[model samples]
Target: MTKVQFRTAEERDRAQWADKFTAVAEGNLYRDKNSPFPIHEYFKLGLLGKEVRMLELNAGAALVDHMVADALTELNISSETEGNADEIKDWHKSIFYQDTLEQTARSFFSCGYAAQQVVRDIDPDTNENTYTIITLNSKTWYPTVPTFKYQEIREGRVVSIFSENNDGVKSWYAFVERHTKGNVEHELYKLENGNDLEGTKLKIKDLDRFKELEDSVATDLNHIPIFQIDMTRGAGKYFGQSIFAKIWGNLQEISEIKTQMRMERIKHFRSLLAAPAQSLQRAQRVDDGEALPNNSKQARVEQYEHQATFDLRQEIMAVPPGAQMPQFIQRDLEIITKAMEMIRDCLSEIASVTGCPRSVFNLDEKGTIHVETEKKKDRKYVQRITQCQKKLEWITEQGAKTYFQWKGDKAGKKEITAELDSAFEMTLEEKVDLYRKMNSDGKFISQEEAVRNLFPDMTEEERTEMLQKIQDEDKSLAGSFGDPVPVEL
Candidate 1:
């Protein structure tokens, strides 16, 4: 493969973007030196523990990651396909729902962004078709160009993608290069040597070039094909802001409240475990007119030590005259409870910013959940999920189309695209009601559609059987009870 060299404006723009991408990524991840996350400081101050938490003592960063990512997992995506389209649709189900993809998304959601490339593949032995969706760590992905709106990556918005890879011994670099030659063409680049790729001859390789990339001295692109999935885009910057930006202020408040609560608890427990000692002054009658020791300090110390030595466990102690036991006050449990309320309040504010409900973080102050309030919170949460699902739909479409095309059935693209819907789902009850209302005025309702809503978890065969039984029962009841036969009566 030959390397193409160009000094065009587009190439320079890509180079310039590489510099800015690193800064943007670091800032988003809170890894930049000037960033305000204070993660290290939190650890140093004992706000965040060094040990991994089996039970989360602090709901700071971990809580955010879990709430956002798990919300995304709630999305139900499926394609409505007919005939040959079923093959593409099945491939779509198989690829996108992989555990590895979900894991990648969660990791990215933690830091505000993620990337995955769909590469087409053809089996060698039977010439069967296959595809791979390779997930990339957002930190390693450097875009060739910057985009203002992340909803869609229009043509020319992203010129290329630069990603760094490591194999333990040395670091390797990969680039998904795009250039216009009548139309946009994508070429993958890697280093001739694994050591460094500061300036080297680039090899034009296929998408699978990532696997054998680390060892080869000559730049080579594996034969994997790239098409529409070549566009590098993922869940954009956290709601279009820095991942930690929304929670930064509230996070510190939570930490301070937690630290104060911990300190108060420790003091309270110590007071309970150990009681205060009584101070005593020995009023020994100095011998009247007797010669006392010249060492007045030594004599007083000996007398005081005698009074201090006592068995407190016996509940009685010998003491000099005028001695008194110290009175103790128990720590107020109300103060601790009030502080917990403050922590909950801070979490509630954070939840408002994250589009996560207080209940998700277990920050319920009312003790009981209100169903209507929870439903309202879910609507807000689903709004965010809908935005992400829209992006994933485009990515999935490319994967499905690539699969069908490689299988020598390019016509399946329309079938796959037409039926693809990754939109948010309504409850079965809602769907059933909707269809029933639409058909209330003697309109025909597809039994398959109605049955899907009624018995969503049932298999196709089971649904079919259930629908048949309902139809048979309806016919029998109509015949048996139809307007009492007039002639027979």
Candidate 2:
């Protein structure tokens, strides 16, 4: 007797997990449904193996994008002091800072951390040094070592390595960037002859053929120019865990359930035709008039059964004359309903793990029975969004300070501040209603306070202008109504 071994839950690889999460986040899962990858293993089962539908709700992308949208809503960053503030704003505009921050947040939420490189360049028009921030691919960048406090970069530094393949010449080369305090180094390497770059056992020696593009630059900053924004860091761990890690199992189950439901629905639509055993044993005429080989009748029946098995498009099943009329096999559709319920439960589980509302996943759209519960979930989700916003705010402020430090503007570095939108999980109508309710009976809240609450992104100047306009409108209404004399009678 032979013993079969199975992989334990603890034996699952983190890299494989990351790859699955990335695929879901990027909407790239099951590109070829027939592929024998482990991720697609569930679909390749039962009688409908090859024909099983690949239905993915892409909950990973939805969760990350929705959280990012909530976290970055109406985000605004400004300077608190005078020197080089306008220049900083201009640089941000030139580099599309808001879009870059959005992409950074997406990456942080999707991949557990976002890596960025600060590149300083000379402005052609002003001939002044300008700073631009660019995100590094998560797979290419590696951060080593972290301080016990705040998890800031320690002595080990950061390295970014990427490979480029030149198909025309059949060559593979690698670009490496090393970032440390006050210095950045760049190097290029070519793969050694007969050494495959993709080989599992390939080493640094295999890519040891140094190309001539070695470069290094020294900076005045006290820390590395690279920034790594972690989603959530564990104690003593250099890398953070992806937000999808907790909900990945639920996501997988949801996909499998949805796929099953789809297959069940297909089965319902194209019911199986049941006939007598000998009915389908007759062979059709061959175009070449070839004689039937031995066991031809059994082979014909098996072929017909295979063709008519799970094919949704097969509308007719022919049988021999005087044979019992084929009857459709009725399936209990209650199984599909049960599967749907299971999917909703899985989504609820995902919502619980992600702090996102189940409504965000498009569950229970027809009624408000779950409205209050979803609102509570929304509030909790908003709190998580606030936490994410704070992280992004810190990153933005640090990025600004770094830019100023690189430009030698010490005053600007001290004064830079970043603010992300604080209002999440509220519609504009809901906010307006809340403001009306707060001030309905009496003036519990002033107009300025209401405006501040309703429109937190407005600048002081804008707020003042808006208040003046409101006051003028009130005076005009009072004049038109002539409120003093008519009410007493």
Stretches of candidate 2 off by over 4 Å are 1-20, 30-37, 40-53, 83-85, 122-130, 154-174, 189-213, 274-284, 287-326, 364-379, 410-414, 425-489
TM-score per prediction, in order, is 0.50, 0.65
Across 296-378, the per-residue lDDT of candidate 1 in tens digits comes to: 98778766665655443454444446655444455767778898778777777767776666766665546333343343345
Name model 1 segments beyond 4 Å from true.
1-36, 39-85, 88-113, 120-130, 146-211, 214-239, 242-244, 272-316, 319-322, 326-335, 363-373, 409-414, 417-489
**Residue 473, candidate 2: alpha-carbon lDDT:** 100
Global Cα RMSD, each model: 13.2, 12.4
* lDDT per model vs. reference: 0.48, 0.65
Error in Å for residue 230 of model 1? 17
Q: For residues 191-271, write the lDDT of model 2, one tens digit per residue.
A: 333222222223344454533334676767787777777766787656677888777677777777777788778878877
What shift in Å separates residue 403 of candidate 1 from its native position after superposition? 2.8
Candidate 2, residue 138: Cα displacement in angstroms equals 2.6
The 10-residue segment with the lowest total lDDT in model 2: 3-12
Q: What would the TM-score be for candidate 1 when compared with the true structure?
A: 0.50
